[model samples]
Target: MRSTPPPPQLQVVAVVGPTAAGKSDLGVELARRLGGEVVNADSMQLYRGMDIGTAKLAEDERGGVPHHLLDVWDVRETASVAEYQRAARVEIDRLLAAGRLPVLVGGSGLYVRAAVDRMEFPGTDPEVRAALEEELARGGSGPLHERLAAADPAAAAAILPSNGRRIVRALEVIAITGKPFTAQLPGSDEEQSVYRTLQIGVDVARPELDARITTRVDRMWEAGLPDEVRRLEQAGLREGRTASRALGYQQLLAAFSGAYDEETAREETVRTTRRFARRQDTWFRRDGRVHWLSGAAADRAQLPERAWELVRDALGR
Candidate 1:
């Protein structure tokens, strides 16, 4: 009698896409269906007290799935993908060891790659970094960002011009490696997977996604996003480089500082978020490993089933 080989011992599922694409809800549904636990990859959602602005699901809304890595960082701490890679891998390993499926969910492309791909971060040079930081401090991020743009236009396009810290880091990397910052990224031919995984990207059309982003921003404002920022500010959010630059929080912080009124801040947040979503889509679409599922507004009702079908097909079940 011939017996079939056993299935792979570890299976990981990731639901990824732009913000306002219902990734969180689909993740919950996948976890429930697969008897899996959820691991959050959203960088902003890792900070405590950032619920409203980051659109983190409330406890009751989690549908009883155990989600790891949410609220893991204080708003005062800077986000580090290296640190996140270590922590997220630990959670994924734990889940796999327990014989439970792990569903990683978020739109943070780099974070997702750090978790599932064999990616290495470049070493930092204190002298070079300090010099860049000093330059940034004296002239602000604009000139340094211009330098980065000339050196690595793709990297610059991916990063927001207002992000001084990231701009400084990119320039530092360029100086250290004597290569474009994007060159350090995992190449299409060179990436290695750390797990046997299924990556499902939630796909939405541009016009529909733009409208959803606008509506989501409006809902955040009505959901007391300003109040949330006010509270986080008191907790030293402005001192945190990463937390202060989050989409809605940054705009609201500027408003609080009288740089702009609340209305202007809200409008700017919508505009910037729409731009950010496009960047996210660009990053994810370049990865051939992602199996995209329809996230169109018109296909809302069938999303979960369609996603599950993909999963089953992948597993050959």
Candidate 2:
């Protein structure tokens, strides 16, 4: 008897994992072979002129495969999950209408969640947002976190002190809507099978990932990261909101402000990037959807093709 065939639906292949795991490269190749379009699901990579640090795929790097969402926003502008969801929905519809598979690639678990899940953060109260912004400007995150803790302790506990923007937004939502932020979010189970998603998680030994981070930071330095930051600073993109606080941008800002020399800033970038990678790993590990693969699990040269094969088989191709 012939083997049974898998069900056909809109295919959404998500490549999610820690940073420095070659997600973009794998996703690009997968799209090239599968006749799909790549949609960036990373928050930082969406910003224009953030090429090196965000590890954006160069024009030639895309190998003529169409990609979406890279350089979609100015670095000075904030890109929220809701905004990403909106843009991603449009792209998903376009790709599906074109009869091409959609490949969502990045380490931003939140962005991926926003794309696949139906979220309830649909409307925002301008009054509440303005009030929160005013309060944050005056007293900073301490009072905001306190307010969030009082109203929605779960959200308070889930968000970090360093994540001031999200914490403030959570409180602002609760203040205006009288609902827990988590409760406002749509059902997690709702996203599980919405789009025939195939989740691939790329992993590597911790030490190896750390080495990759170091090497990537060194490469960014060689690629004129200092000059890039100088240009952004000159363009008044230095400080405003969360986008300015991204890993390399913040470090380079520190260097620009004389907080550290170029060498020191680069080292700080690598160190903090590794920590960020660890946090990403922790977050993605909670996602049971991912099929984990190691970089050195096979030869580096053949690994991406092997990963594609695994994804193909997982999709029952």
Candidate 3:
């Protein structure tokens, strides 16, 4: 008798949403129920020694489920979504080959897209990139950001003025392609995904999310975020272009450097984080493939079961 063809790999399930929406716990619960492992998609969580501010789950909190891609990069190394995409796909493929589901989880929308979607990053010209970096160093991000705003208002709106690295990248892309940077993103014509994916978005009201963010930031401070930053700063965090700019770390570093007081840094962190959450919501809302599930704070107890129901429904199980 002829050998039979192997079974198709199961669809990759992704849990995504704004920060403070309880995605980590829900991902762990889903992995437990679905016989799956977790693949982290949060860009910040990929760095070592970034646990407290990123709200990374501890081992006990993971409930024995295997998690891949956490703490994969040093604080001194810049994070590349393309590199993350490749690494994440390797882990996902490994889990699938082992007959286990892969539950991809995080609030970083672009990283999630890079992992599962047919996303392609444009090649960078080193000369152009170097020139942009030099320009950024000499004049700061203000002039370049204004140019970006004129060239691609949407991209500029999405990127913060303080993010010098991204500002340079956008300008470089604009120069290389002779088109707006955002124009290269996957449009309706390029929606094909590499894996069979079931995307679940955790939804929370703005007020509740803002409140949660405040509480979480306060908890981070109580949990020794300052000390954590101090440790990482000794580990060369300030020299790490990407790692140094992480939400809480950036503000705390400013405080450590005497640019601001600790209280002001803490308050700015909360304010910027709330703004980031709004941007995350806007980004995910644009993707029509997401199946949104209510994740209100009051409904916390029911989230896991509700998430499981959504998964089962998606799979027609």
Candidate 4:
């Protein structure tokens, strides 16, 4: 058992990294040492009944820490970052007021930033949004992406062409604000956070992380991810605006539609997840505030201590 007492001024700690990089376990350990509770920042983990695919820690795996902002959305609901920001801040504030540290955990870069950084969402214009959404529905994302590329090449480069939702929103912002979406976004270091934060990033080498992801996907299959998906399907997962499009679930649904076999779907899930992890790594690496610690097996024993050192440094201990 960990015997070191909790720190006096443990305010906020963000455990961030790519999938299968050991962020969750490390966050639990950090929360234990900091007298903290966890508030999730994973966008996918917000959906109910998404446990196995999201690698959401079961109750027994959390090491008794109280967690918030998970399983708050039904499968059919569309995800909203603004709504998530509000909900997460409420819990963080409650935890602070109650004298418990707030451990913000996950690899969703934008969601994490929305919770901690002073980011403001611009107002939406209904006419502009409706027109843009109608265009997206008609011509697919390719034409719209070309337009975005012409208008704001940076945002187009950042967002995927197949991501019609974000592309539409980006165009909507351009039409409404008459400015590039990225122009209004905060730089890595320009914005101030709502609370004092010590963000610790857990990472391993590419090969090591790839191996971990493969092993995790294998384990999820063995743990009946198909069964979980089936249950969610009964609960309208296919109709979900966001949940149906998640990593593993999307691949599995393709299999269900006879697009591929389950084995092929699983294999593709591993490959797609590896690519997603690379993107996640790039996102966290761009941030200057995070104190990164290796999650290699050799370093696993010292991860908690290394994170504690960062916390102490942040506290000027």
> What TM-score, computed on C-alpha atoms, does each candidate reach?
0.95, 0.87, 0.95, 0.92
Q: Which clashing pairs does model 3 show?
A: none
Say which prediction, candidate 1 or candidate 4, comes out ahead on lDDT. 1
lDDT score, candidate 4, position 127: 92
Evaluated with TM-score, which candidate comes out highest?
3
lDDT of 4 at 113: 90
How does model 3 score by TM-score? 0.95
Q: Name the better of 2 and 4 by lDDT.
A: 4
Q: Which ten residues in a row have the lowest lDDT in candidate 4?
A: 184-193
lDDT by residue for model 4 (1-317), tens: 97997654446899998999999998898888878899999999999999999999999999999889999999999888889999999999999889888999998888999998888887788999888889888998899999999999988877777667788888888888899987766677734777778889998999999999999999999999998998999999998868997888989988998999999989999998998899889888888988889999889999899988888787778
Give candidate 1's TM-score: 0.95
lDDT sort, best first: 1, 3, 4, 2
State the displacement of the C-alpha of residue 88, model 3, in Å, after optimal TM-score superposition: 0.7
Residue-level lDDT tens digits of model 1 in 38-72: 99999999999999999999989999999999999
lDDT of 2 by residue, 119-187 (tens): 657467788788888988798888888878888876776566556788878877777677788677545
RMSD of each: 2.4, 3.8, 1.8, 4.8
Clash pairs for candidate 4:
none
CA-lDDT, candidates in order:
0.92, 0.81, 0.91, 0.89
Query: Candidate 4's C-alpha lDDT?
Result: 0.89
Model 2 off-target regions past 4 Å? 1-10, 138-160, 186-193, 297-299
In candidate 1, which residue pairs get closer than 3 Å at backbone N, Cα or C atoms, i.e. clash? none
Query: Candidate 3, residues 167-245: lDDT per residue as tens digits?
Result: 9999898999898888767652224688878888999999999999999999999999999999999999999999999
